[model samples]
Target: MAQSVHFSTPVDTVVSRMRALDTALPERDGLAVFNRVYLTVTEEFDRQLDAGLFPDRRAAISLDVRFAERYLTVAEDGRAPACWRPLLQFRRHPGVRPLQFALSGINAHIGHDLALALVDTCRTLGCEPADLEDEFDRVGDLLVSLEERVREELMPGPDLFQIADPLTHLLGSWSLERAREATWAAARALWALRGLPDLAEEFADRLDSAVGLAGRMLLTPLPI
Candidate 1:
């Protein structure tokens, strides 16, 4: 028999663990780490939904909303978590495709929030929003291209290994190698605005530490 797990506990534990790890990071880099962790958690939640681990799509989205709420609540108080409440309610509606769309919207919301946070962090170091926006756009383009490849080649056929190959070889490699690319860009933008030499380094260190912690959590076995 398969064992069932409560939705909130493991997710909360992971967030709490992440919080401890966040302490070692610089503030700017910490935000990037938080963004990565949020993305990873949301992606895993979606994967569970696809695998039928939840009773239905509704259940999956409900669980996701709960997880997101817990995550945001822990990270920045209850403010941002309130935004995800609508997503939870949307799950109760009928229709698989609409539910999927809503989930996509939720992901977009989270992404935008991260991007804006990056901009704000840069601004605090005296960087211009336009410069940060440019970097964000560049990163978004790269992500879109990678996503297209994953959708076209990896998801369409029975040869799962082939799809996994590129995702593993290309996207995975890029993510690992350039994990701090966003922080670098943010730092550079800040430098351009204020000539802050230490700002970028500080942010980069924090991001690296956070990512390391998140990687460990991902590898850890959950009770589920």
Candidate 2:
């Protein structure tokens, strides 16, 4: 089940909560690894918002906050899709590389949470996913940019890229571009399923499990 959040100011609330998590969680914790990446993105988005990059700031903020809330909700309620389960469950495992932790969170959030967030934003705005396409594209671009940083900051040294390197192969398998496209399609499908809650839940569950499986593989507790 999703946790209920009461935000007097949606954007500020989400950003502050993420910052708080950043301060509270250990630097090496899996969730903390992802939190750092997400916090950077959120700060950038807030800067962009202040600069008037979004045409409908209110709508964009609503979407952004709602999207973030999905991830945070999982942290609070522990009732998350299978996709996020691995990250939460392995947060304290010293064997998982920070890169793996970061990517696993990205997979869970983009692969599953983003689709649901789209539906949530649509409901709040009385609009459709198409109506928020610009915001989605903008946010996706930000996330993609962050992935490059993730690679640079977390990828092992050049000496470790041998043919037998499991980390290299694991990181190579996932692509932010492909994830974004799939997420968009999933969002559309989920929106279409809104009228059938049971079917929608089933679809969401499958997505969760599939992404979770990928995350599990990524967090294979390599010899790094």
lDDT of 1 by residue, 41-147 (tens): 44555445445655534433433344344445534552433333333333233321221222233243333234335544444545454544443443344445544
Candidate 1 global CA lDDT score: 0.40
lDDT of 2 at 128: 91
For model 2, the stretches where C-alpha displacement exceeds 4 angstroms are 1-9, 161-164
Model 2's lDDT to the true fold? 0.87
Model 2 TM-score on a 0 to 1 scale:
0.91
lDDT of candidate 2 over 25-68, digit per residue (tens): 88899999999999899989987887779999888998899889
The collision pairs in model 2 are none
Error of 1 at 161 (Å): 26
Error of 1 at 46 (Å): 20
